[model samples]
Target: MAPPNLPFRLIRPAPDPVLAEAVLRLLETPEPASEALAELAMRDAPFTLALLSMRPLQPGEATTLKRALTERIDEAGDALLRAWLMHTGSQQLQADAVGQLNMRAGQVAETAMHLAIELRYPRPDEAYLAGLWHHVGALSLLASTRDFPVLRDQPATALERRQAERQRFGIDQIQLAAWLAESCGLPPTLRDALALAGAHEEHVAGAHPLARILRAAIHIAGPDATLDEAARLTGLDTERLSNLKTDVDYLSTEGLKSLGIGAPGAAEHERKPSGYPMLPSGWRAVALGGLLAGAFEGIDGKRLSLRLGNAFRLLFGKTPPLMLTVTEGQVQPLPMDTAQVAPHLITELGLQVDDDTSVVALALRTQASTSHFPGGDGPGRSTRDWHLARWLGTAGILCVPWQIEDTPGVAVVGLDEHLDLPTEEQQLMARLVSGAARALAAERTRRRAMDQLGETLMASQREHIRRVTHEIKSPLTVIKSYLGVIGQRHPEDPTLATELNQVSQEIDRVGRLLGQLAHPESATEEPRSTSVSGVVQELQHVYGEPLFGQRNRELEIRIPGGLPPVAIPASTLKQVLLNLVRNAAEALPEGHRLTISSPGVLITDGRHSLELELADNGPGIPEPRLHHLFEAAESSKGGEHQGLGLSIVKDLLGQFGSYIFCRTHPERGTRFNLFIPLAKPA
Candidate 1:
């Protein structure tokens, strides 16, 4: 008989005690071997399902569930697997019943493998999985319902057993299994095979090939008197069928041996309770409160919903509560974007606030805690309550109303029907929800403030750029006009005219760069490559006199002919060379020299690049200063210097897929090596 108000929690059963112990031992190692864990996982049905449910299936994954699960086990790594094992291991199972069920599942799985091999089915592994999990619904029922073991062990036909389950629990094991398979997002073919495994022989004739194999294997390995029917379904003769049965029996015995389950005497001795003892209620509440406080301690605005869900998980153990947001009298789920809550739930649980039938709606209306059960009589109880019980795989639900400072909402948690919470625990849940709402509201306020600050900063930056652009353009216009005057006056001198034209072109390039700064979105033109030889000659002509000649420092250019063009515009390359040359000249003494050279091509990661070296014979930079040489700081040269030269040089080179490296010693002067990518050929 069904226990009164059975909890009907849809929990995956724990793994076999022997297997759990073995897995825990492996997890205790510094690095657990994935292959070893996978081998054990394949032998246990609940453990395999738990591993698969941890991750969604990838596109173009392996066709069979067994292969897919093997991949998932490797991907999950040891930490996640260990945590899940510990969580499930805390819930103990009745040893005799679990052992019997596990052994039957193993036998059925082995038999399915043999049948698929004989029939030459394409996916024999998937057939094995279908057989192994065929009785998962019964296992789940056994885990949640205290009196389920008697029904499971009773002597009855498969159909009669299903009828009994439906009568007692309002739903049969087959329905439960199908629902769980759907929830896990199992492949359609495998889901159909699992759902159809318990159907009658006639009902499964036209089913999937894996379904037929699973059905035949169940009949062969079970205690039902259907050996003749199994033979007719699989087209196997009497002798082969007998041999198959004998081999499966031998294999089942070997499987038990591998699991360390000896004969009855040793097996009974090994069947100790695997779960830990529960703490006292007061201590448990304190521990839970501490955990919840930690969950909300440093809530990040970006990850507010994730932290909230975690806090709820701490409050309500394995089954976390579902959260809904209320907005202007319209209620919907928190916008977690299908990652936290399944999509189907979002569709089904949307309710109007004035709908008198929903407990969730009533909680919002009265702004208090409310609850509903399957057979309860109240104004708030309706068909929707029954539907929610089935969908959540629970017998009842509790709705706790919360508000984000005047915006009211509700938190709905699935409850074990048999669980009776003390007043203190209920009050603790209310306080936890209140704290979560406050955290969320504070996060919202923080985000709004951050958004406003960002807008203000952007406006200030734009204004600064506009002022800087206007101030720099006036000087550039004056320089260009002055150069034009010099060019016209020196029309007879070709050398002077060329120098004036180069200066004019540089002034125009600066103007264009300033325009780009003001409206960066419009700067979409492709970058141009600069000829290294040409840029070197232009630098010598433009800044050779003022920077080095005026400072009594010698400048040497040692570039080879026929070097490839680098991936930077000529104007940008000139600016970079000017910055380095000016810094070197300023740091060098009266007679110190700077040597600029192109040291051939470099191959890095299969790409060709040009290496440019600027070496100086000035005093070497101190070690402390060299470490942060490129960072902007107070200028060691003081007067009119902002120490932005090297920093700007670094930023400009990075924009063109180039890098800068420095090396120096106390005796030897400093060297800056620039790696500039060679431009692609047109």
Candidate 2:
């Protein structure tokens, strides 16, 4: 299982000046600052190119490494270094005929760091550098030997490759790389780590942690590496192995660009740091819990805001304050962040409709993020730079507009930190926004529905009372008529006279029931111009047979000639008449007569109008119950009828500036008189 030492390799008695200088630089600063490296690269393009040509960095290869160094390194410096590395290497590989070996070295470095993270190896950056430079010896040998392509193209095992290399050059790539690392003053650990690539399987397992990780990365970086194979070699599960592979692919790609490896003149290129926050394991579920808990706390809106802030804190290092412009019909914040603004601010913003250029407005329109400066600057200073700064303080403001389908309003949020993140992290923030929106939308929808239902119920109740009043009024009129007739004939009889007096008192009481249906002065809305005689005739034809024929009651309607149109809808007049006729038929017994007479009248308002009187002959209503006739749920027919009919008649007529009155005589039956206004001539 041991790797063989190649037999032939050229040994350099002296190192090249460029190589010697690079080694000297390493010796001078064992751990160079990222800033110094960036400045050095910027200062010398050739040096930067030479350094990048040292290894290849794949795109996005340095995410984990950058994250690990975020707090420890200068971000700008790190960015500059990465950008140049990508620019240089990418350019060299594209232009140079022999760039494959160099690209492979970069790939090795990227994969090594990935494995380091997966295996929890220490000093991952150092491990990465070690892996990248490990193949420098091979590259140097290939550069000198014109037909080395033949050697590289051979399908050979690690052991066979070393043997072939040694046979040709008198030394193998392993020995050459070890010598270079030591001469370059790379730490002994890195030097040893590089040597592990040539170790036997038994020796590999017992090597230093970094060396073992590098060996695994080197194995997996081969064209044929698979998840299962990587797992077996690195002791990682399939899931971890897959993750490591993905990380390696992305980090290496990015790392190459960061190091300016691929792009030759792109050393000045600025690579955007992954806007994505690096979250801890299982942080997504925790964030979801906070969102749900906050939403369930109620529609008060504060709980959800607080939970969102908590989720932000967990995803990012610190939680910034958030301001939510909650709107149903107007913009206002939850009770939490309201004090930040005053009434003048509200007026100045004029958020009732919102301005197209305001922060909230832009958020609603664009659905993208913006900031005042490179990093988020404070309020006032950048308020001119970005409108969001007007409200959000020193921290940068991030706004996302959310809406509910079929709702008239939207909620715009302004947060004090950057929300730019990778897709997964962005989804988390989206989930939070969406969850809050759904909760708010649901609440607004529910409240609106409840309001509509309440209005419908009230209207229905009012209609019910009106119908019952109309129904009872007709019978009560009959009762009063009978009492009056009895009194007229029984003046000499005290008992009969007392009963008549009591019945008269009850009829007076029933008239008072109309008071409950009284509308405030403002209730009289303008009436539409309509024909009164036509409405009456229509009602008579529709209901005359059904109601009158059953009880053997005859309905007679008499209208004077040239009746003017009325100021009421035809439907309203028809409803009122139908209720009146139905009441008359129900009150009158077999052989009783019901007559409707319309008499022309000239009102003081100089309007021509008419009064309609409906009279019916029927059994008298009881004196005790007569007083409650027009009251809601009160009925002369006991539970069989609700006393809403005449109340409805009054309500309908009032709409057109008209009204109804009732009169009756004992034994003469009941009569109802309705007055309707005539429309002025157009």
Candidate 3:
């Protein structure tokens, strides 16, 4: 099947005598000294070349293949043979150690493929590669440094282990694994899989089966792990898990034998039939006591609600339809859903309870199982119970109260009628809800501090910009004044006059830019009252001919007669229109025309506002950049434009309490709706 023109060699050459002797000496020993072999393997190139020779050799070019195998072997025979023997022995030892730890992990690729095929998942090849290379960084670290094995004794999570390795060495296992994978010419998919060692923390709720299985395989093989914990984490019941465990044990022993290492006989004694751990006699006391002692961990500020939702899922096996926080006689639903109940519903419930009876209102406040049956005539029955039963259509309600530093809050868990939860489960749910409240409270405090810091930084930055632009503008203004005087005095000298006028115009542009940058807040203030019709007439008289003449495009202004004055000054209106007109003209093609038309609809809330639409015939804004068109520093225009025109226009429009809405598509060209408030009748 080989192409005739292909020059790469496929055959591996035989070892030279000196190299063969070195391999013989290593094989002859009962156990080759790992330290000595490791020292030799440290010289990377010769060892790698020897391993390469075991595969089919490719000389690559015809001229290189022309040389005899003997000649190539003879040139580096002694050094290559020694390195090759050392490499082979060291590899065998490493495979044995890793196999002893977890046979499934040692032969991870083949085992992963076997599991994938059995499960009927797609891409067995990708799964195999993901499993095989996931722990390659650890193996590489062992080969390169003798001290790496000591790290195994440190009890740490996968993330913690990598951090410790990074602290001791210059690089971590994941980084090291990536480097080896790349050097061996493995695909990027393999490299990426190896890099995802601790990615399970991020996708806990809806992880892919491939990711879940890989995690299960590693955890089951890990030292100090029990079958119960691994099964729970992997979503595998005892019956199905027993078979997987048996397979892992058998495959691991076979893998060690294939690598020429004696099987670890002690492994048989450690095996146990798959089952949940026996509940410790005092499990409830221990678990609840630990919770009471504040043994839980905190989470990130931004993901408080999401993490709380996941916790709820863990407790109930399904997320509740609604979770509302009751604070200071008010009910606030999580932002995830806002349509749970009407505002009056919360107000009605809040009125029925006082501060002394708040805890009793939420039924599951303690670990005790207490329920209120609809017609029970129970000892502690109250009027509030009847109201709750009648309005909510529930015989009973469960609530858990959590306090953060003495600030009391209650979490109401909405339930379906069919589900009846036990008291033990209710206690666990209480612990989870309490942890969420603490985390949310902590996040809110941190966010408040961050907001204050951000405000201070913004104020400082604005002041700096104002000071710097003022310094620059002072000299530029003086220079423009002198240039204007020169132009007026030397009107007869056409060339000199023309140059002076051009200089003055450039200075004016710079001044406008500085003013825009130094006083952005000024554009967002209240607008002066002015005539909308008068502003439109001025734009037509001043810019209509000049704007259209240069681009050879039509400029049409269609405003109805007798329009009322709007709440925008003439100058502010002119600037906003100028930016819009220029933008339209630049975007339009030679044959395209820009039109400003008013439909004359008065939008009234407390006061009346008018709507004007600017339509243009041009290629529409690109989809990717359309959402960010009004944001400063984002641009589609390619030349000298710095993406400030539209951003400035947006800020100026805000000053008049008006806004622009943009609509565009490839076929429809573009349209902008400008909404402006009309002045009260005088």
Best prediction by lDDT? 1
Error of 2 at 392 (Å): 6.3
Judging by lDDT, tell me the better candidate of 1 and 3.
1
User: Which candidate gets the maximum TM-score versus the true structure?
Assistant: 1
Model 1 lDDT tens row, 1-682 = 1223434544567787778778878877887766778778878877776765555455434246556776666654443354345445445466456556766787788899889889998767767777777877777787667777778678998788888888888778777776666655556776787778777678788887777888888888886536787777788876787789889888777766776764222355554543434566567556555545444545564455544443333223424466666656666766442234564565565567888888888988898788887754532457766666556666678887777766787777777565664465565666566666676667767889999999999989988998999999998898888888888887899989887887787787788889889878887674579798899888888888888898799999999999998889887788888899888888888988999998899986577999999999888898878889999988888889998999999999989888889998776798999888899998
lDDT of 3 at 180: 49
Report the Cα lDDT for candidate 2. 0.55
Ranking by TM-score: 1, 3, 2
What would the TM-scores of all predictions be? 0.55, 0.28, 0.40
Q: Estimate, for each residue in 136-157, the C-alpha lDDT of model 2 and write its tens digit.
A: 7766565445545577669998
Deviating ranges (above 4 Å) for candidate 1: 1-9, 31-39, 51-95, 223-227, 238-259, 262-482, 490-506, 515-682
**Cand. 1 TM to true fold:** 0.55
What does each candidate score in C-alpha RMSD? 11.6, 27.1, 22.6
Query: What's the residue-level lDDT of 196 in candidate 3?
Result: 54
Model 2 regions more than 4 Å off: 1-348, 351-357, 372-396, 403-427, 486-507, 514-682
Clashing residue pairs, candidate 1? none
